[model samples]
Target: AQSVTQPDIHITVSEGASLELRCNYSYGATPYLFWYVQSPGQGLQLLLKYFSGDTLVQGIKGFEAEFKRSQSSFNLRKPSVHWSDAAEYFCAVGRLGGYNKLIFGAGTRLAVHP
Candidate 1:
């Protein structure tokens, strides 16, 4: 079975600080990796995704992530955090066989302090 795991359930960081969210996965083969962010009571928005090519990928909202196939991990990172960036982050994995069935981790809630 394929699964996604996020080590942190919640994270608190002061405004303008740096941020990094960890993600790990188990799959039979190379799987599609993605990071998504959701505001309070809002739908999720894609932060980044790794499909096939390069080891690093960038996405909207000033976010980026590096794909490490060796460790079966794709971690999300941001150089600086803002109060507006406070939200729940989820790591997900999918199969490239057109399954489109995204398996999401429990999620990590980020709190930004002033």
Candidate 2:
């Protein structure tokens, strides 16, 4: 079955520090990878996606991810995290001709300390 797994259930980091969120997927073929952020009581915002082509993909809020097919991983990275960046991050995987249903991970809560 095609699914996504976020190893870290939650993470706490200091403000202005680098952050990396791990994501692993189990899919038969190279599927569409995406990173999304959800604030408290708010809808999820698409960070980035990787269909095919360049392995390194950039996204909004100064976030980026690298798709490693061999590893079946698409990890999200941020150079410097801000207080506003403290939210729930989700890793999702889907195909081109699927039901358009996005299967989200358990989610990784990021806590930023000033």
Candidate 3:
């Protein structure tokens, strides 16, 4: 079975500081990797995704991720984080055969200190 792991359960950073959230997956083949952000009391929103093509994929809200096949990782990064960026980050892995099923890691709660 495929699985995802977010090493950091919680991260605190000053506003405007660079941020990187680690995500590693275990899969037989290259799988679809995604980063989703959930604001307080809100549903998850897709931040970025890596399915194929370019290894460095850009997503909404100044966020990006690099798919490193060798590392089995698709880590999310932001050059500069805003106070509004404080939220829960979730890394998910979806099999190539289906999109409906996604195995999510234990979310990383991000706290932006102003």
lDDT of each: 0.92, 0.92, 0.93
> After best superposition, candidate 2 residue 1: deviation in angstroms?
1.6
TM-score for each predicted model, relative to the true structure: 0.95, 0.95, 0.94
State the number of backbone clashes in model 2.
0
> Model 2, poorest ten-residue lDDT window?
95-104
Question: If the candidates were sorted by their lDDT against the true structure, best first, what order would they fall in?
Answer: 3, 2, 1
Q: Candidate 2 local accuracy as lDDT?
A: 0.92
lDDT of 2 at 67: 96
RMSD of each: 1.1, 1.1, 1.3
Tens digit of per-residue lDDT, candidate 2, span 25-102: 998765899999999999999999999999999999899999999999999999999999999999998866747677
- The local distance difference test score of model 1 is 0.92
Q: Mind sharing the TM-score for model 2?
A: 0.95
Off by over 4 Å in 2: none
Candidate 1 lDDT by residue in tens digits, 11-60: 99999899999999998877899999999889999898899898889999
